[model samples]
Target: MTVLILSVFVLVYLGMAIGRFPGLQIDRTGIALLGAVILALAGAIPGEALATAIDYPTLFILLGLMILSAQFELAGFYGWCAVRLAQAALSPVALLALVVAVGGGLSAVLANDVVVFAMTPLLCAGLVARGLDARPYLIALAGAANAGSAATIIGNPQNILIGQLGHLDFWPFLAACAVPAVLAMVCVFATVAFIWRGRLELADASPLPLSPPDLDLWHLKKALLATLVLLVFFATPLPQEEGVLAVAAAMLISRRFASRRMLGLVDWHLLVLFAALFVVTAALARTGLPAAMVATLANSGWAPDRLSVLAPLSLVASNTIGNVPAVLLLMQVWPSPPEGALYALAVLSTLSGNLLLLGSLANLIVVERAAASGVTLGFWEHAKCGVPMTLSSIALAIGWLWAMGHVGW
Candidate 1:
């Protein structure tokens, strides 16, 4: 049973790192689901224990946030923001700064992946229409999304999980990460601007038609109201999952958008991914090998409980298996981690994901959308900006956390 569980876990994480099997169409979500299924069939995790293995609170919170973001999407709010950014009569460098600013700011509150998904194509079309190179802007958009999402727990999937599991306060989490996130956005603008210098204009490009969704002022008003209510809940003693779920339910009572459409827009793929990882990790924990290994590692001065160790580990783990999965895996192995360590983990894992194109789902979404828009944003092209931006931002995060006495060496 132990061997079987370990084998399944290894195969699933390998799929995560490589993104897929050589000839299989299965993605990280599928890999995780399959691992859980394998464990259940082999009796590594009994059907009765399945319920205990999954964390439903985390899923509910994710679903609620997705619904909130979907409201913005259906109202054409995200597209409108992108169009405005593109249509602004700013210079090349100024335009880059605006892209980073808008992308980061929106991502700090909404789901970063969804924000990038809605903005990428429209932003690309607008830039190309203006005869400007869209490559740098797209890269900055992805990096900004990653960096900005670090500011709040609800900003990204990994941070959401960390916040829920760690029982982190919303305001304090924001206070801890806001500065690093802001500096990271600056890094995004600087790195992209420096690398794409003198290459901002495209002479032969013609104006491409923008296709943003028609603005629904009424629905946008409702979204804003719901967002304010959510903030109120966060400030109070009310449970986050319950409050957000309530807000999502109220949004569903709308006459403009159908419940089916709103729910469909939610990333069920990501939700399933989180559930599947929870099951897989739980099954492995039943083997007791993880606790033993952690004990040995802790005694050897190599535990992920300190700033120095966690920073590098987060960088490698986040860039490899991805930040969400890396955080889930670490939570399983690291028993009863300190609150400060949790903050460090959340900030470091998120910032480190900006190191490469394959680092975050937001980055991949931007790249894929750009490719569809005839803008080639290759791996090395992104790395040129991502590498430096990530390194600098990560350094800033570490310094801030350490100086503030949030974490120890």
Candidate 2:
């Protein structure tokens, strides 16, 4: 049973790293789900234990947040912002700054992946129509989303998991991570601007019609109200999952928007991935391998709580198997980590995702949408800015973490 669980675990994570099974259409989500199912069939994890393995609160919070972000998407809020950014008569660098600012600010409160998904194509079309190279801008936008999403517990999926599992407070997390996030956004702007200096302008650009987004002011107002209410609850003693579900319930009561459409915008694949990975990791945890490994690592002075170990681990694992999966693996292995360590994990894993094009979901969304908009953003092009931006931002994050007494030697 132990060997079977280990084999399944290795295969699932390997599939995660490579993003698919060769000669098959199975993706990461499918792989994780299959692995969990295999373990259950093998009696590695019983049905009752399997049910207990999943963390429903994390899923509920994710669902609520996705609904909130979808309201903005459907109301044309993100599209309107993109149109505004495209029309801004600023210099290339100034526009880059604006892109980072907008992406970062919106992602700080909403889901970063959804923010990029809604804005990427619109922004790309506007830039390409203006005879400007859209690659740098697209890269900067992805970087900004990742960096900005590091600020709050509600910003991104991984942070939400960390906050929920760690039971981290809203304000202390902001205090610990906000500065690093801001600095990372600055790094995004600077790195992209510096790398794309000579290629900011295009001579023979294809012109396309940039249509305005369909605006629904009333629905937009409701989404804003829900967001405001959510923030207020965060400031209170209410459980985050309950607060999120309450707001999501209210969002479903809309007269203008259908609950089906709003729910459709949620990333159901990701939610399934989370549930599946929980089972996979829980099955492995039952084997005692993870706990034993943690004990050995701690005795050898390689505990994840230390900044040096966690920073590099986050960078490598996040870019490899992806940040969300990486976080789940770590949380499973190292249960009940220090509060500061949880903060470090959230911030570092998020910021390190800018190092490669496949680092974060937001980055991939930008790339795909850019391709649809006739703007090709290759891996090397992204890496030119990504490598430096991630390094500098990570350095700043480590420094801030040390200064705040979160992690140190």
Candidate 3:
């Protein structure tokens, strides 16, 4: 049974590594959910064990955040910010800076994937209108969102899981992770600007037709107020899950927008992936391979809590299976991880997402959206910016972690 479970696990994760099953159209989520179903039908996971394996709190928090982001989208707030950023009178370089700044800033508070989705088309269209190539802007947009989301617990799906499972304090996690995130955003801007220096703006570039997003002050104000209330709750003694749920509930019931409209925007597929991965990981753990692996690492003096050991591990894992799934797998072996290490994993895993086009969903989102506007960001084009930004950002995070330790943080 253990061998069978482990075999299924390996095959599923192999699918994850390749982004799909060969000769099959299954996505990562589909692959994962299928693996869970296979194990359950094979009696590899008992009913009682299945219940404990799925992390409900993490899922609830993630679902709530997704709904909250939906409210922002349905209300046109995200599109409004993008249009506003596009209207800035800044030069190409300065505009790139604003893209990184706003993209990263919004990601710190909202779902990073959603942030990229809402902002990419606007940036692409805006850049083309200004006779600028959308490649650099797209890289900056995606990279900044990934980096910035590392600053807060609610910033991304993986961070939310880490925060909930580790019982991390919201304020402290933000404080510890913010410095690295900010510096990473700078790294993103500098790297993109330098690489695409002369080619940043294309003088003869013709603007692509882009329909402007709708904006409503009424819905926007309501969503903003709910976000404010959520932030306040973060600073309170209330459970983060409760605070998020309360805010999400408020956003779901709007006077103008139907509840179905906002709710439909939620990433139900992603939630399915989380749940299915949880079951898969739990089954793997029960086979004792995870414990054995940890024991072997301990014997070799390797520790996930040590930045030196953990950073590279997280980078590879994140890039391979994607960050969210990588973190979920690592969590089982790294029970009660240290505060610094936890912060390191969260940021490093996120920062590593800028390594390649397929490194994170955010990167793919930007690329796909750019292609829709007739702006192609090929694999190498993204890597030209992604590789350097990833290296520099990870280095920055390591330095910050070291400095904080020295200062008794």
Candidate 4:
């Protein structure tokens, strides 16, 4: 049973590496679901074990945040903000900075994925109208969204999982991550500005078409009010995950928008993937392989010494299997890392998402949307910004962590 579970785990992550299973129509979500079922069927995990393995607190927090984000989206707040940014009479360089700042800032509060989905089209349309190259702005928006989300516990799916699993408090985690996140955003702006400068200048500055009028003001106001209330709760010393989530659920119920429509905005596929991944990874945790692996490393005189290897390893694993699963796996081996190492690990893993187009879902969404707009950001184009942004952010993170004595080495 242990061998079977281990095999399933390896195969599932291998699928993640390849971005999908070969010769199958399955995506990451589908592969995860299949892996979970295989573990159950193979007797590695019984139905009860599987049920217990799912992290309901994490799931509830994620669902609540998604609902809140959906309310904002349905009210067209993101679109309105994007349009306003577009109409600002700044040069392309200034405009890029604005987009990155605003995009990144919002991502800290809302899910990065939803922010990208809502903002990408408006940005693309705005660039096309102004004859400015849209590619760099689109890339900046995606990269900055990922960078910004690293700052807060509720910012991204991976962070949410880490916070729930590690029981990290919101404010302390924010303090640890804020520096790295800020540095990452600056890196994003500089990298994109350099790459797109010439193209932006050469393009004609024709007047753009008017943005579609803002959505219902009343609904937007209500969503804004709920969001502010949630922020106040988060800012206070109150236990954030459940408290803020209850606020979200309340907002969802009070909506003039139909319940079906609100629920439809939820990323059911993503939620399913999280639940399945919980079972699959939990099964692997029970297999004892992680403990054996750790012992082997310690015996080989290769025990991780915090600043020297673990930090870089965290970035690599995050890029490979994603931050959530990588952090989950790492926690089993290094259960009680030094004071701030867990938080540092979280920051490093997340900021590394900018290293490649496939490193984060936010990047993929930007590329996909760009392609749909007849402007594709190929792998190399993305790496131009991703590499520098990732390197700089990691460097800054290491410096901060070391200064704070978070790393044992």
Top model by lDDT, which number? 2
Question: What TM-score, computed on C-alpha atoms, does each candidate reach?
Answer: 0.97, 0.98, 0.96, 0.94
* Model 3 C-alpha lDDT per residue in residues 1-409, reported as the tens digit of each score: 9989989999988988999988988999999999999999888989989999999989888888888888888878787777766666677799899999999999999999999887778767766776777788889999999999999988999899899888888899899899999999999999999999988665753443445687887887887888888888776778888888888888877677898887788888899999999999999888888988887887897868777787788788878889888999898766567777888889889999999887888998888877887899899988888999999999989999878881122
Q: List the residue pairs that clash in candidate 2.
A: none
Candidates 3 and 4 compared by TM-score, better number: 3
Worst 10 residues of 3 by lDDT: 202-211
Cα error, residue 334 of model 2, in Å, equals: 0.4
Report the alpha-carbon TM-score of model 1 versus the true structure.
0.97
lDDT of each: 0.90, 0.92, 0.86, 0.81
Which portions of model 2 show Cα errors greater than 4 Å? 202-211
Clashes of 1: 0
lDDT of 1 by residue, 1-409 (tens): 8889999999999999999989989999999999988888889988899998898988998898899999999999999998888877777789899999999999989999999999998898888887888899999999999999999988999998988888888899899889989989988899998999999755644444665568999999999999999888776778988999999998898887889999998999999999999999999999999999999999999888899899999999988999999999999778988888898998899999999988899999999988998999999988888999999999989999999888898
Worst 10 residues of 2 by lDDT: 201-210
- What are the runs in model 3 whose C-alpha is more than 4 Å off? 202-214, 406-409
Clashing pairs in 3: none
Clashing pairs in 4: none
Clashes of each: 0, 0, 0, 0
